[model samples]
Target: MQVISITDLNSVVNPTRLAVPIDTEQQHFQLAMKQTCMKLPTEPLLDAHPQIDRWIMEVGLLFPKVFEWEPPQFLVDTQFIAKLCTKKKDTCVQINTNAVFHRNGYVNLIEWAIRHPVLNWSDKVKLWVATEYLSLPPENLKLTILALHPTHPGKRYEISWDSQQHEETRNWLVSVVTKQATPMKTPVASQVKSPFPVTTGADFDIGKIEEIEI
Candidate 1:
């Protein structure tokens, strides 16, 4: 919901201790998040050729504990997996990060995404989000709409932010960066490309959500 300025992201900083469990240092998460956003693919509304790769890269950089999955799992559900599964007939999503690791940072990012208060899609019931990533490896930047993680298997939600809600999310983002998390900013008034395509005032989602350095 909060479309962060790719430029201003460099200066933002959060002092509060992050409960996120990560392989790389705190700096890595911020860098990876921003870099992934920066490299987001642009041009059309339907394309993940680059976005998916960026997602995997950013996640890996931020959580080095998570190695690159050998055979990425684009979608997670058992039924869906059954449908999308390749000829090999492997049942589980091959995780990039080795041996099913769970870190606080991974949990927080997923949780923050779900309860973002921006795009209301998920529920409060926590369903091992780590599983969701395995179940559904995001393939596109628009997939960022998948921001909210699953709180429960049965519950499903979707909300579009109006100007007010967008403002709420945007402001909340500022707070998270300034106080809640140790994030850096890139300063206001910096010229940055819009991450999403021509939204045409769409109801939800992002085309390219993160920032990348030129």
Candidate 2:
């Protein structure tokens, strides 16, 4: 949640400290540098909506070098920062610019949605009926933004498409969204006590066992 600015790189990485000699005692320093230089993994989106995926890809291509498909990181965590003062070439411009562009774009979209009220539906049944009949291709599906109601902060805007569709398609989309929102529960293993305890060394009585005919 911390918005790390480009100028705040010093807070995450100290150039003077990394300049220290890499001896046996400074192994941790080496490990830290390795981790900092490693590529960050990207997180899966809430839903696998085709349109949304395409939109994200398009945004990334706008600044191909900056907006990579990997997880966003603080300026200091980038490889560019690690190579900043070193003999390595500085390649931090793309990431920094990409981060700013991504953050600002989302902020602007949210603000615009809050200010404009294109459609309002008070009836829940009507909204459901509308959504059930709606049909739109990935390309035609306009960028629909949802925000908390201005007066009623607790409630959110109900998004619906303007076209009609079959009941099957409506149910499928609903199921997809529902499944994505729900968190998966992992089963926990319980510990059980053994019925018998065995003795070791001299206490181990193999002679006490009686031979039985099978």
Candidate 3:
């Protein structure tokens, strides 16, 4: 995977189209799924707390439809509605309704998303969490996870300006952002902070990952 920047994201993504209005069928599906999950007692559902709220759950249900992807079937065993928000059988995209307040909190959420069995622990996947307020024409900074590997999911994904793979990564991100429809705001470099100092002598840990500002 190539490194992706917020500027790169802005050039490709149209904010107005980030999130399409939730349709009636999706609303009905979300309600039905919520009712079904509420009845089943499962550990995954409990473990996915705070992360498994009403709005995010609704986004999870509508994600496939918005992206024009196949909807995942509800599994009774997992008992978590989000477990069914898979994109391509392996890619699990979790939408966040709440902003991650601190660096540790942000890291923890990514770790949880990466390790959760609902996601199948897939390393090839990118977990895009829409950490923006759920109002019409969203008006706050958004948090997006661009890392390639999940083993160290908290690490930043930096775009190497001179690399051959830059365009490849750029195109991939463009495809994703255009399809997802979650608006992204311009990031203030001064305000964005990485929790830990980047490791030296390696390209992977060079640039800082963009932080979510509330």
Candidate 4:
């Protein structure tokens, strides 16, 4: 609920300390991010929708990047941020720009981006804003961002760019956002009593044996 603009914070905080809190925020944003976005390992859209994942994979292979797929990134995240802040279909260049920087960790980079005279209030500078709010490992986090209609949209980038896919992606992201597991708490040794006996030697096996089969 405490959504801080990525660029506004960088002005006051140290870059190093800012990193963790921002990362923590991104972890928080995942709920919102995954909710309205689509990715590979993408889930069922109404369980009856056609297979978008396979389509994205196939489209990815066609790309020049020998890596097999362009791989879903925060392009979708920034786009949504643009939507969240602006109810209007048209996005602000600064807001989008800030979202990009915010998605990525360019705490220092934002000041430079805004100075670009070409940036328009209506333009929506998505590239810069997203840069500040980057979250790592969700790719391996068993989620994927893929297109909605494979044939019509063709690929993730193309689909993401489509104005029509915006709501669909947002709807999908919002649904799964809560499903991603919370960061697991590490179990403390003292918190969990070992079944093993505290005293060794003669009584070594007794405490640990909660139940005896014989």
* Candidate that scores best on lDDT: 3
Model 3 is weakest, by summed lDDT over 10 consecutive residues, at 75-84
- What does the lDDT come to for candidate 4? 0.26
Comparison by lDDT, 2 against 4, better one: 4
Better of 1 and 2 by lDDT: 1
* Candidate 2 lDDT: 0.25
Against the hidden reference, what TM-scores do the models get? 0.21, 0.16, 0.20, 0.21
Give the per-residue lDDT digits (tens) of candidate 4, residues 84-123: 3322232221243212222242221111110111222122
Off by over 4 Å in 2: 1-47, 68-214
* Every model: Cα RMSD to truth: 20.1, 27.1, 18.7, 22.0
Residue 62 Cα positional deviation in candidate 2, in Å, after optimal superposition: 1.2
Give the least accurate 10-residue stretch of model 4, judged by summed lDDT.
108-117
Task: State the C-alpha lDDT per candidate.
Answer: 0.27, 0.25, 0.28, 0.26
Model 2, 50: alpha-carbon shift in Å? 2.9
lDDT of 3 by residue, 1-214 (tens): 2333332333333232334343443334334444444453434543554323443343344232221221132221121112122233322233322122233323112211211122211111122222211121112222232222222223222211112232333234445543434354652322222222222112122124333222
Q: Of the candidates numbered 2 and 3, which has the greater TM-score value?
A: 3
Residue 60 displacement in candidate 2 (angstroms): 2.1
Q: Higher-lDDT candidate among 1 and 3?
A: 3
